[model samples]
Target: MKLSEGVEAAIHCAALLAGLAPGKTLPAAALADYHGVSASYLVKHLNRLVAAGMLASVPGPHGGYRLGRPATRISLLDIVLAVEGPEPAFRCGEIRQRGPGALEPEAYRKPCGINVAMLRAEQAWRGALRAARLADVIAGYEAEADPRALAFGCAFLERHQRPGSPLSNPE
Candidate 1:
């Protein structure tokens, strides 16, 4: 199943936040700029992440966003659920009972095999996402990123980061 564009944005933003030093936050504008996305649109997805408890919002001049928990503790599935909700991707419509040759209601008392198989596939997809964590994505990225580039990124983020701000140090 194809995920919405917002899901892709949320995942990338989460990973970027995961790379920040503890207590450091990146403003939504910066996140939008970094990804070349619309700030307002991105904020909608960010809010979803906030509501899901995957990310926390810090309000104020120095306020932006930060992970609500450790990267390792947040799964891809958590982000997916946050952006997409918990509805199963494959919704079974009981198509087996809709046509002219449809089986009698009593004849098909059990769940349709097609429906069951689809549900199983959806479960497997969810399981794969659940097995992945933000930290895993970051680790893989850092492994492949050039050392100079990585250092530059850390420096850039640090320069833009607001420290000791009231919102930055959330209670």
Candidate 2:
């Protein structure tokens, strides 16, 4: 199943916030600028995340958006479901019942192996995504990501991390 570009943007935006100092936040404009995307459209995905309880919208001068909980508690599946809804990628319309040669017997109404296989594959994909948390992905990347990219992420966050932010690890 093809996911919207917003899925990619929202995932990255969530990851960025995952590293922010606790209570510190980044606005939709900041996230859009980081990815060179349009703020108006990107905020659409952001609002979805907020509604899903994956993000919280803060108000006022010190207000912006922040993770609603720890990164470890937020799975990739959650973000995907938030943006794409809880619909299954594979939709079975029971075409076998509509064709002229369709099976017709009290014992012939079972799902075919092909349909079962497709359903299994979709389940496995969802399982893998659900098992993946942003913290896990970030930790994996930190181990092997390019030095320049790592530096850029750290520096970008450093510039944004607020003093007394709870997200930062106390030195």
Q: By TM-score, who's the top model here?
A: 1
User: Candidate 1 on 79-154: residue-level lDDT in tens?
Assistant: 9999999999988888878989987689888888988999999999899999999899889989998999789777
TM agreement with the true structure for every prediction: 0.89, 0.85
Q: After superposition, how far is residue 156 of candidate 2 from its true place, in Å?
A: 2.5
- Candidate 2 residue lDDT tens string, 1-171: 799998899999988887777567777777788889999999999999989888877766656677877788889999999999998888887776667787665545677676788889989999999999988988988899999998998788777654433443212
RMSD of 2: 3.3
Backbone steric clashes in candidate 1, count: 0
Candidate 2 deviant stretches above 4 angstroms: 103-108, 160-171
Candidate lDDT scores, in order, read 0.86, 0.81
Model 2 lDDT at residue 3: 91
